[model samples]
Target chain A: SQQGEEDPQALSIQEGENATMNCSYKTSINNLQWYRQNSGRGLVHLILIRSNEREKHSGRLRVTLDTSKKSSSLLITASRAADTASYFCATERGGGTSYGKLTFGQGTILTVHP
Target chain B: EPEVTQTPSHQVTQMGQEVILRCVPISNHLYFYWYRQILGQKVEFLVSFYNNEISEKSEIFDDQFSVERPDGSNFTLKIRSTKLEDSAMYFCASSGGFEKLFFGSGTQLSVL
Candidate 1:
């Protein structure tokens, strides 16, 4: 399977603490995206980092990609209870008719207690 | 902000029955896609449509599955015969290019 794997299948933290998750992929990719899915809800796009990018930030969320390691990490600063959800990393391959056809990772489930 | 929209949030169907899940992608987006997630499984891409044609599809998308842009605004996925394994949460996503995707609240399909 071309799917990626995320580390730390589950995490729990108190509100205001930072939460971090890691993802590793096997193939060359054009870009990697992070998405959040609340329980029984649709995925909400969080951020996207291209293969050439090393780090990116959106609000309190920070994403870092290391091509040499074929891995990426997502950090949510000052996490709140509302930040509790399953986070997934999806990689878009480079070749073929790769029009946003993403291979998703086994997500990391995060729980932030208030 | 524009967003993708899917109809029939939940559908319970019997085996061998045909089912069509509907989606209305963002108006300005040019690409549409279908993805599925079985309970606790990673999201898997099924097919992608662009310019009213299928641009990419996964092996999981077999002959029994079909996609259509019936009108200018809607995209639909049709499964000829439902199977127990077909039960999953189907998500419809649209993208302007490749930056980020807008996803709709998925349709939970339960096949019995």
Candidate 2:
């Protein structure tokens, strides 16, 4: 079964605008994390919000997690053309030798037009 | 500024052939992982290795697949007999006992 499912499938925005992506997952989780992948590039870690934490931020990225609903959201403020990429949500299952293993979502393709 | 590094940005092999995708994880990290993504598909986990043994693996990690940490620095994933369905971008990632992972650029494998 797929653990993470992202909403909207795709998002588009203009420079200086804000883009938001939502993710829902099944199974109990230890933490939820966000990653970005540029065309033909590797996944880059963005931010991590623990199950206990409600919200966290880094630079222009803000992440919020609601464990009760098993959902998370990533908001990129003041978006730029450089922010065009695929955004994925990943989860670390709560039980049994996780070793930081992550299950990734299909991802939301975000295009920022300048 | 450390990062996971993978070799052979692209690999093309015939079906039933053996293939080895290599990775060099960060020196201080203790865990390594292999994930793959088919064109237009979600990234899927294959296996995770720690302390020279596999800590966890997915159903996709069948008998034909294997992972190794031959030395202190290099981690590798080997497919004994490749299948046409195995064509995908294989990614190598590592973590220093944390949830935030560092991933390599990936090896695009094509099995024909």
Candidate 3:
């Protein structure tokens, strides 16, 4: 089952623009992670933000998590044509056999025009 | 960077026929998992395995589905009787820890 719902099902922008996608999830989570999937390919782990951490960054990607609102956002700085892909937010619920299972969001599809 | 590897990039089988999907997780990773994504849908978790036993599974994983760590490196998901709805892209993943996961390219199963 899906635990999170991403807003803006699709987005189109030119290169060099920043793209932001939001995700809202139900239930408390130990961590929220973002992944990227190229068309017809596997998912690539992008970043992970623990429940205690508000924000985290890796390279051009930034992720923010807010447990209070049960929401999170992913930001791609200086987006490029190569950054065009589907982004998904996955949550790992806290405790009780939730260990390695991840519930993913519907995903946001971003198209970067070069 | 080691990766999780899945075999038979694409499989076509008739409904009611049994199918087996194979995966080889990173050598050092202890946790293994199976997930499926139907075309144009969210990725759904199927099962997770650790210490040679199933740690958790979703309701979607009925009696028809079974997982096996047949050897030290190979993990397999077997569907006893495939249904038309069983068609989807199945991904195998592994994690050394509980947070970050490495996913395989996936196997696209088509049950006709």
Candidate 4:
């Protein structure tokens, strides 16, 4: 029972194409963050978008959040083979004094072909 | 960039045995957390520690599991008695701020 469920559980794309993955959450959130996990590696922090913000950009990645719909999308532009990894969306549960205990989604497995 | 580090890339133990997973969070980070991911499942929060005390814990973090920062630089998670269900990848993380967190490579626990 994950709070955030990512759509398109698996995505495969060729190099240089844009990949878009969407995530939907059940409860309110203080913020939503994206992470990338290479096989047998740690989760790398990608980006964090606060509840008040609608969209954010970093490097070739762009994230859009729609609070009303309780959904978010991560867009990776010009995806490279190196970008192939599992992408997860984590939401810091709102209305708490907790110091960022994030609830992560099942993650979308992205496969980029060179 | 400073990153969180974990020891014993993999640990195998018999059911009912005790195991302690070790982690060294970024030196300056004050907030630390433990999370686990079962095979094919999402990452689940287990506990959060700050100011030398446990700030929050999840239902999954039962009486069998505990966390401590015995020293200034290291954080540890102790499972008094591990079960087969406890087999999972345990991740240690730290954050200087609540917005972004750095995670360790994770210790893969296999309970037999």
> What CAPRI-style quality would you assign to candidate 4?
high
Q: Write the per-residue lDDT of candidate 1 for residues A39-100, one digit (tens) a residue.
A: 99999999999999999999999999999999999999999999999999999985667868
Question: What's the TM for model 3?
Answer: 0.98
Candidate 2, residues B1-112, lDDT tens digits: the string is 9889999999999999999999999999998999999999999989988888899999999999999999889999999999999999999999998678999999999999
- Span of ten consecutive residues with least summed lDDT in model 1 chain B: B95-104
Q: Give the alpha-carbon lDDT of every model.
A: 0.94, 0.94, 0.94, 0.94
**Model 4 regions lying over 4 Å from their true place:** none
> Lowest summed-lDDT stretch of 10 residues in model 3 chain A?
A92-101
List, residue by residue over B1-112, the lDDT tens digit for candidate 3: 7888999899999999999999999999998999999998889999999999899999999999999999999999999999999999999999997579999999999999
Across A10-68, the per-residue lDDT of candidate 4 in tens digits comes to: 99999999999999998988999999999989999999999999999999999999999
What clash pairs does model 4 have? none
Docking class of 3: high
Each prediction's TM-score versus the true structure? 0.98, 0.98, 0.98, 0.98
What TM-score results for chain B in every one of the models? 0.98, 0.98, 0.98, 0.98
- The interface RMSD values of the models, given in order, are 0.7, 0.8, 0.7, 0.9
Question: Which residue pairs clash in candidate 1?
Answer: none
